[model samples]
Target: MTIRAWPSRRLGAGGLAAGALALAPVAAAEALYVPEAEPVADGVYAIIGPTDARTYENHGMNANYGIVETGEGVLLIDSGPTAFSAELIEEAVAEVTEAPIRWILNLGVQDHRWLGNDYFQREHDAEVIAFEQTVRQQQAFATDHLEGRLKEAVQDRLAGTEPAYADRRLPGEEATLALGEVRLELQRTDAHFPGDAMAYLPEEDIAFTGDLVYVDRMLGVHPWSSVQNGYEAYQELAALDPETVVPGHGRVSGMDRVERDTGAYYEFLVHEVGAAAEDLAPLQEVVERHREEPAFQHLEHYEGWHATNVNRAYLEFQQ
Candidate 1:
């Protein structure tokens, strides 16, 4: 699952350039299929998946979930996109270990994080844990956005199913949960979202970074006013030295690869967007010009989201 960082400009070569343009719309309609969980280290597993449908104002990439097996119980990281996928994850975990799933540490409050809460809670009595900010986002999603465009995109897959929201929250910089010999560390970060968090299993040298580190893709900018903190959030994640890095989306990779590739994407965004800002260019032109950047090149299939990311970066640049 190692992702090498290539120059964004090189994506123009071969059929990638034309293919990106052709597949943009088709990619948005497709839901990322869940991948089987694979062991990254002893007792630490990565739940990898394909690129999710691009619909939201943000959330351009799919997410990867993590699971840690310990003597006491199992610690599950971010839930998949829907309740159906979440249940599958639960069944998969059960196959390997009978220990109850004690804690579900949500890295953020997006659908990928909390929608699966009901499934885990009802079946394993697992506690849904997340940053306080994450809880707030969860409420916002439920009351405001979850049932709208978000639901419409995956309604077929969720047919006749409802997701349960969590009732509890974790607050501040750090929290630790002891699952047998493994200590799961949840560290708060402000990268992809206000409540963004990362989970680390020290004994296994694995860290599950929610959307904070988007591997092999463009980093999503926050849409809120005066917020360009996503880049800073990436720095915070780099500070946590882990051997294996499981991202919110894309393949799991070595810590070095995660840091290098994610950092490169951030730096590229800053440079490309900053240049556009300096020229006082419109958001669309900026996105159009940089469509060839490696971070965004493969995402030609997700052009619908380009406007959203561009708007976010444009606002941040102005502030």
Candidate 2:
């Protein structure tokens, strides 16, 4: 109902900042909030979030979640940051359908995707489903990073949150399900993250690509991500030719928009980073050089992640 963007901590120039924020209530200083739940298609409600990450304002509601009201029950796309955030999502879904949540498909293992799992399982007895790799990564997040790496940064919003993991693990292969009359498709793409998955409703011609596509923000590549693989993942998604593409962050857009933006980003990395690796440039020099490039210089919050992405791919190419 209320929304705004807020800033989180960034250690230094190289420290990554969460330019994105979650959708939450309007507060005194919070600016990045999830705008509102609106229908993008017949049964699909988009809880589009602020195109940022855990911030003081959003209270950690950065990731978007899709709710599909079906004959059986509601299908939740991804769990949010905390129990309170999930409750907000419940409010959004209630606006559309009163059916209880049946299942939740986690799109990735990021802090945003699975932390709210505890709330969903407790409230609706929903089964959390994710790719096998995602399940492992989720466990790692809980056991290793939950309190270690992320605690202080987001603890303010993670209050009521406990780690709830996936109960079902699906293979990272293309799979389809018949949700009543709506045809649902899950395609695995090892782009943004190893276990990243995308959901598509063929009947409605609407596709939800986890983080593989960012409409207007700087596309981040995880330390383990591959530019080559990420580019390939984009190609597969572009081929689907969906009328409306729901990106992991940012607004929903057409295929051409994402393909043009993200497609160009990866292409630049594959060539530039690959060349830097081949030329045996000093690691620090290569990272510094890429950060000043035309593409990296002008994107929304590009400095926060562009160098990291370039170095990760460069190291991969050298190996």
Candidate 3:
């Protein structure tokens, strides 16, 4: 719970500067964190966040969350970035339905997805849920996430944000959650993060793909990322053929967009990079050969991230 005074990385332009600027003055920060509930179906809403990088201006609201009106109460898929952002999410949900938030699902261990759980649990006593592996991952990275880049970007906006692990952890790869008359089928995937998940609404035929898919922005392949596993997960989710997909980032889209943006992208990285690694191709050659990929060049941050993604995938495959 200690807000480490980590040195600001970006100094003048957008960095949380040393003194008072680090605080980001909640009023100004809140302005950019406003959650606009976009309706995906009757009573189901996607609170899409910014596709840009996390910064003080955006309050780290860089991941998408969901609000589902289950007749009896509301079911939230992935909480926002901070306590205040959670409040903003609540306000946005109020515009759509008057129901109180009953359940909050942490689709992945990502900070934005679950860091706001403490706020909702304290305020509305919402039950937080995630897969057991996800809870472990959250427990592992909670400190780093809270006190790491999130604090650097949003600074004091992350105040009062505590790591509230999921109260309910489901076992194995998948399970079905029945809330009132609504049923959300949750499946665990190993795509963007360890224990990332995607939810399918059988009634609505809509898929809430946690971090398994990124529709617009280029995905970051970290040391923990597995291109092989990610593509496999994408293939499985694609097989389900969910009519509509609420990607972890970007707009609410369909399977075609998911295939083009995430499925094909992951597949390309794994196949190309995997083949190169097996042949002992140099990392630079791999990076150079795939840097200007036409299919994904249009995505936000593609130029900046594509090479690093290729490098990471090459290293992962090499191992």
lDDT of each candidate versus the true structure:
0.64, 0.75, 0.84
Candidate 3 lDDT (Cα, 0 to 1)? 0.84
**Stretches of candidate 3 above 4 Å error?**
1-31
TM-score, per-candidate, Cα-based = 0.76, 0.84, 0.90
For model 2 the TM-score comes to: 0.84
RMSD of each: 10.9, 7.7, 6.9
Of candidate 3, the 10-residue stretch with the lowest lDDT total is 1-10
- Quote model 3's TM-score: 0.90
Colliding pairs, model 3: none
lDDT of 2 by residue, 166-217 (tens): 8887766677776555678887777777777788888888888887777778
TM-score winner: 3
Model 1 lDDT tens row, 213-261: 7666545564631234556666666676777788877678876667665
Q: Global lDDT for candidate 2?
A: 0.75
lDDT of 3 by residue, 1-319 (tens): 0121224222223335456556655444333546678999998999888898997767888888888989889999999878867877777788798899999998998888898999889888999989999999888888889888999998878887888888899999999999877998998886778888889998999999888889889888888877888888888888889898999999899888888889889888878988898789998988888878999988999978888899998998887
Which is the better candidate, 1 or 3, if ranked by TM-score?
3
